[model samples]
Target chain A: MNADAVPLLEARGMTMRFGGVTAVNNVDFVLGEVELRCLIGPNGAGKSTFFKMLTGQLTPTAGTVRFRGEDITGAYPHQVARRGVGIKTQVPNVFDGLTVRENVFVAAARLHQARTARRIADETIEHVGLTRIAGRMVGQLAHGQRQWVEIAAVLAQEPDLLLLDEPAAGMNKEEVARTSELIREINKTKALIVVEHDMQFIRMIAKTVTVFNQGSILIEDDVHTVLSNQSVRDVYLGRQAA
Target chain B: MAGAIASGWASFAAMLLAGLVLMFGLPHVFDLFGLLQMTVFVAMAVLALSQGFIWGYGGIMSFGQSAFFGLGGYTYAVAVMNLGDSTGAVALAIALPAAFAALLGYFMFYGRISDAYVGVVTLTVTVILFNVFNSTAGDWYTIGNAPLGGFNGMPSVPPLNIPGHPDEPLDPGQLWYAAMGSLILVYVLLRGVLASRFGRVVVAIRENETRAMLLGYDPRLYKLLTFTLGGGIAGLAGCLFTNWGSFISPTAFSLAQSAQIIIFVLVGGLGTLLGPILGAVAIQYMVTLIGAQQKVDGNLIVGVVLIGFVLLVPQGVVPVVRNVLQRLFVRTPRGGTAPVASEARP
Candidate 1:
């Protein structure tokens, strides 16, 4: 909702360490409804680790995670997903043997209606423009098409909050543009927290950006303001900004 | 549509007819021991199917399906012995062991062990059970009136009782009929399950565990359910085994037996529902054909066959055969009625 209201997901003083290294440190973040936020960080910034903690794959060493006003710290990944939070990994994670429609149907099944699952699966596949190949095995699809199938699967979940770990990990300009449009579309109904390395893709979809460095939130601002900041460029964007 | 049903019935009738031909025809030509050996192979085929449910469809590779088989043997023996001479004893023998399998499967599966770990854990359990039963005969009069027969297993185990003919010991023909009935029942049940949502999820888990988990389907729960159901079926096979031979031996619990069943499942095609049966029959036929020629190690021959099958047709003979049959006899359906339609998109 807001800083004052209960955010869809709230991580307060979240810290995670792997032995001697602190992967994420005292990170306080909130994701609100219809909010599209991007987490931008340099390589080795622990963005993946931080995201893993949120999904309950790894427990935060210290912190409280509240999802939908309920404390959900250290919940199983599957259990956490049932609370209306769905995550799409950086790697495409579709059943290689299953058809696109089946993949979406599997995700839609979480909503608990056989008829609705099929209908939603069909709608999601069509919406994602995967209808043409909806009957093909995911393993047969091109890498970019496979990625859209993964997105289609997540959309079928009808998540209240969608956590996307780099939806454009490997894509050309056209695919990236299509993914940006898909992201924009998904953001209209659900809160989105996307971690991305592609600034162009991020700026195209994310209204606000959170920059992470050394496992902590370095700064949070509107996309335009963050991009134009001289200090932001000096520390992280000097080479890339050129 | 009629052709499909007719062909399905024809294949089934042909199998039964061939079995009858083997029963009446073979005995007319060969000896009793040969027919008995054939019966044993058929029983092994059923066991392979039971094991396939967990290992192939559910991704739980268990080396201890034989333990359920052994349990079924012992349970049937003990129940028949207790009942002294009733047909009801035969029913209880199969039912009790099947129940035990279900119970054991429930506990093993609900514990949330990894798939490979489940195999190891079950194998260990099987070994433990083997030793426990193998040693039970020593304390002859301690528990029951009769000894458990230990390593030698129980001999003179009561034969299955026919309802009105208590004095008649079931002949090879009757045993064949019973075995065939059981095989068909198992076939229909497993086929139905494999086509259902639960089967789809089991295969999905086999394809990708994490995706199934992240999508709200608990792989462990499904795995446990599958393992237990499979165990029960295997247990039924064991009950039949004990009844067929009128003896129980530790050989039923040996790793060799486990390996044989595993070979049957894998050499058949791991994931396909009917693959185990084909594998079972093929391997049994090979063993029979080869054993007829010389005194070679049966297990070693099975190993070579498994390796050869893996290299040539990784999907196993049943899948390969089905693929060929589909191409030859089936017409390509247009406008989304295709079999691979669901496999096209993801």
Candidate 2:
């Protein structure tokens, strides 16, 4: 990706204040088209808060978030999604009572007509390796499978940018490996920002990583550089160790 | 999905046929009074359907549905007296309540009122309307020639007339057909709406609002539309009620009447289209029978039945019956195993 090309997503001086505490402070980030970036940090390090602001889940108290070169500050989640930005929150958000296929179908239906949505849902389900369990209720699925279902639902939207929060959090090792592969495959066509604490999983998928600490970006570098940075280790890896 | 929709349409057709048979064929066995009583049940079923669509499917538990019902009745009564025409009055009856609902719903939904507060606000609105209507007994409390009638309630409400001729009011037999026809029409229409893309989105919102929003749907807009549609249906039911009893009353806005509507949806199967109708007709018939016997208070029996249904079959009659039927008959294609039973959860 050319550095001179217009980035797919750009956040400038973004800050979020909850009363007296500043959850995210003055974060500037950029992702190029077809880029795969991993955001890693300790709990309450403000990575999640920054992701929320980027995805329109939370409006920054100060600063701007631009998508495709247009300001989308304080946009509602629905509005953001409609702009071809797919978001999967930290928790798996799938309709429990609805079938896996129906879950994807509803998401696809948001962008396409009903007839087209059906085809998209099936194709997305198959892409997510959930074809066999398409007819099964989402609630009955295992935790990892439910997470994939949520991913499939987001893919059904055919978004240009995918923002996934802790997509591999509860997954077993095999599931995590599969998820890393899935994210890499998707990154071929769409830009992605995966927020995860698992270094191994991030190493498998991310070429570049952004480290967040104290509500601000502490470092942005290649995976090797970020892993070797002493400050990154002290604030994030040190906290994880404790 | 197509198969599910086809089965839904098939059930709708079956219900329509059954309704026609009961409406036209039953008169031969029952007397005029019996037919008249059946008309009232049909009207009540319409009211229950409105509640079912809003509360059961839309996941909006409203306790002010009676406000719309009473609004419809009063609109029809006042309009009929002024225009001397039932056709235009009927239109106004449905439109007035729908418009009011749209305005009220816009504020409540857009204001982001919480679910619990929604119930309280709606219930309070019904109570306020009931008290207001109850106090309008003065000579000045009149719309056109129709007096408010205060606690005594408005009497001699003009019956629905033949479309063009105001002098020719519908006879009892015609009124029965009109009520039954309206019920069938509303049922078919509601079923079709529920099968549409919009209906799927609405149901998805009911299931998981945040997920629906993340899918690019504005939940507030869908909620407002559903609330307004439900209000219109309730208004239609109120029009039918006025025609059946030839009266309008502040009792239409009473909390008891609103609670009874909720019971009808609960006993029938909340999300199922036909469940609420069945619940309403069955309960109304039982009430009429018990009232005729004069041994126990009809309301007391209804209260007991409501409690029994809530405790024994919380999912409602239709869903429980459907589950049993599915378990007994439905089998998976891969194996001869019985299909999993999934209850509707909002």
Interface RMSD of the predictions, in order shown? 4.6, 3.6
Predicted structure with the largest DockQ when compared to the true one: 2
RMSD of each: 4.1, 2.2
**Relative to the true structure, how large is the alpha-carbon lDDT of every model?**
0.77, 0.87
Q: Please, what are the lDDT tens digits per residue for candidate 2 over residues A180-220?
A: 99999998899999999898898898899999888989999
Error of 2 at B98 (Å): 0.5
Per-residue accuracy of model 1 over B1-346 as CA lDDT, tens digit each:
2233355555556755654565456556646676677677778777898887877767787889899899888877776676666466656655665676667667766666666777787788788888887777666622355568778788888676677466876786567656766776777677667645676677777778777767777777777778778877887788778877888877788887788888887787777656787788778888788887667877688788878877887877766776698789977442232333111111
For the predicted complex of model 1, DockQ is 0.32
Give the C-alpha lDDT of model 2. 0.87
Q: List where candidate 1 sits over 4 angstroms from the true fold.
A: A1-4, B1-38, B84-113, B139-146, B162-170, B293-295, B324-346
Residue-level error in angstroms, candidate 2, position B113: 0.8
Residues forming the 10-long window of minimal summed lDDT in candidate 2 chain B = B334-343
The 10-residue segment of model 1 chain B with minimum total lDDT is B337-346
lDDT for B1 in candidate 1 is 20
